[model samples]
Target: MNRNIKFDNLRGFSMILIVMGHFIGTTHFTQTYFDFAYTLIYLFDLPLLIFISGYFSKDNPESSIKAFRTIFIPYLIFNTFWIIFIYLTKGYVPADMYLVPGFGLWYLLSLYLWRAFLPTATKIKHIFVISFILAMLIGTVNIDPNFLSISRTLCYFPIFLFGFYFKNLEEKFTIKRSYALLILIPLLIGATLLYLPFNSTILILKYAYASLHMGNLKGMVLRLLFILISMIIIILLNNIMPSKKTFLTKIGKNSMSVYILQFYFVFTIPDIMNYLGFNYVFNSTFLCIFYVIIATALVCFILSRDKVNKIMDILIIRVTKILMKKTTP
Candidate 1:
């Protein structure tokens, strides 16, 4: 299978947005801007990440084992770390507001689940079509929010299947400029409607059963539309600013490490700046941007180091190997 450097770079960029969205979410920003930023992030962030993940799938036992080690193991390790970190910081563990309840590690957990189901999902013709319809139907009914696992799984599983299907139909659709505009225009329209007063009724109905604010018919339409737009923009950007070397590609390769560690900067730096009485200046939107950029660069630099990453990878491998052996025997 041919690796698309373009898609890989786009995936890295999407991760940056995920980090930025989280940062903004934690900060005190204007409600309108915050909502807009969040809508944009939700529109395509995880879907694109999942789609890119599916793009790397191969039908081999070695790749499957690597997936278990690289994806599933890190997911479990990080969830445990998050639990411990929260427990130590606070007297008690709170509900997982980061992604979903009890599963603050939703990103990793969902990806692991989706990947595990890929073998079965791929065999079905029109898997995405079926999943998408079900997602919309479930979104419309207003299910109980307490069943968060079921709600999120229903909402996201379709997109996961969409990505898997996209990988299967890679050559069927051309990434054309016209298709890009077609997707972008509808996305903008849908997003605009979401902020309108008329959308309140639909929004209320949608949120009744799911913590997901964007599960309604209108919202899902916009979400998928934005995913299409994101793909188009990524393709266009890739064509315009084509990388001649493998530098960005290498960075893209290690995006997972960048992702898991980014939270340290997102959550910690703002508090630290406030403590130092630098919050007055550093709390500005511009400063937030600067801090995030610098912090991301610093993180990328640290993770890109051969010695540090090698040690981290070795530890992860050893831990996963032990876990696997214990589970198997």
Candidate 2:
């Protein structure tokens, strides 16, 4: 398959925001600037990630099995590690956290499901409508938390479908970089203005919440709004970013390793810094900027290493070969 550098750039952009957003979320201080920054990052991070995932999705048995090996195996392995770490450190085991996806591991599970569902989903006419209806209907019900990951899987199915269709959409309506700035300026300002009243509500909706006491209809309405807004941002981002190889492109190329492994530092580093009595160091917004830069660089450096990628490749290959054998004639 030909490499789509724009998609890689998009993933690189989203992955950085994901890491930064996680760091900011776990930090102790809260500022209006931080809140606004966090909201902007939150708005498109997952949607962009999922959209790119769908854009690259291939429908075939080999690709399906590869997705299982690459995403699901690592998800299970890392989740087990997370559970053990929590038990050893916190002195209590949240069994549910392991059995279900805790932290950001849900995306990996969701990606596997989306790829698996694609064959059947794409064959139907009006899939966009069907998927949206299913997502909205699913939003109305209170799914068990143990099954929350699957709820998100269902909730964002439409976005995935849209990404799949974006392949067609891009051919007809390519937004040039010259128009990107013009379009983005108004959208960002409007989104910011709207965010004042709806910040927390938007956050709740972004997570595909079953209910936030807004009742089912309103909750569904908010989610739909979020979906629309996220798509617009995704489009703008695709237009704005350079479609060439760059530092981020390298990071984006190895985004899976960074995505799966970065949480280690995201969750733990603050504690480590605090334990080292570096609270004063992390207090300033300037310092936080520095931290974000360093943290992102460190994550990219570690995950992009040859040894680490090789190890991951070995495990993914081993698992896929076994599973493929079982299913093959």
Candidate topping lDDT:
2
Off by over 4 Å in 1: 1-3, 31-35, 59-67, 94-104, 140-149, 175-243, 282-285, 300-308, 326-329
**Model 1 residue 240 lDDT?**
42
RMSD of 2: 2.6
lDDT for model 2: 0.76
Please, what are the lDDT tens digits per residue for candidate 1 over residues 191-268? 544544333223222243234445455666744554445455433433443434345565566676666766766677
Q: Show where candidate 2 strays beyond 4 Å.
A: 61-63, 145-148, 199-201, 204-211, 319-329
- Candidate 1, after superposition: displacement of residue 195 in Å? 5.5
Q: Each candidate: how many clashes?
A: 1, 0
Overall lDDT per candidate, in order of appearance: 0.59, 0.76
| Best prediction by TM-score | 2
TM-score of 1: 0.74
Candidate 2 residue-wise lDDT, 1-329, digit = tens: 77788788888888888888888777755767777777777777888889999988887666666777777777777787778878877898775875588578888888988987788777889888988787777666666634548677877787888788888788565678879779987786677556555645444333444445566777677777777888888888778889778878866777887787788888888889989988875689888877877887788778766577678778777766765555547
Candidate 2 collision pairs: none
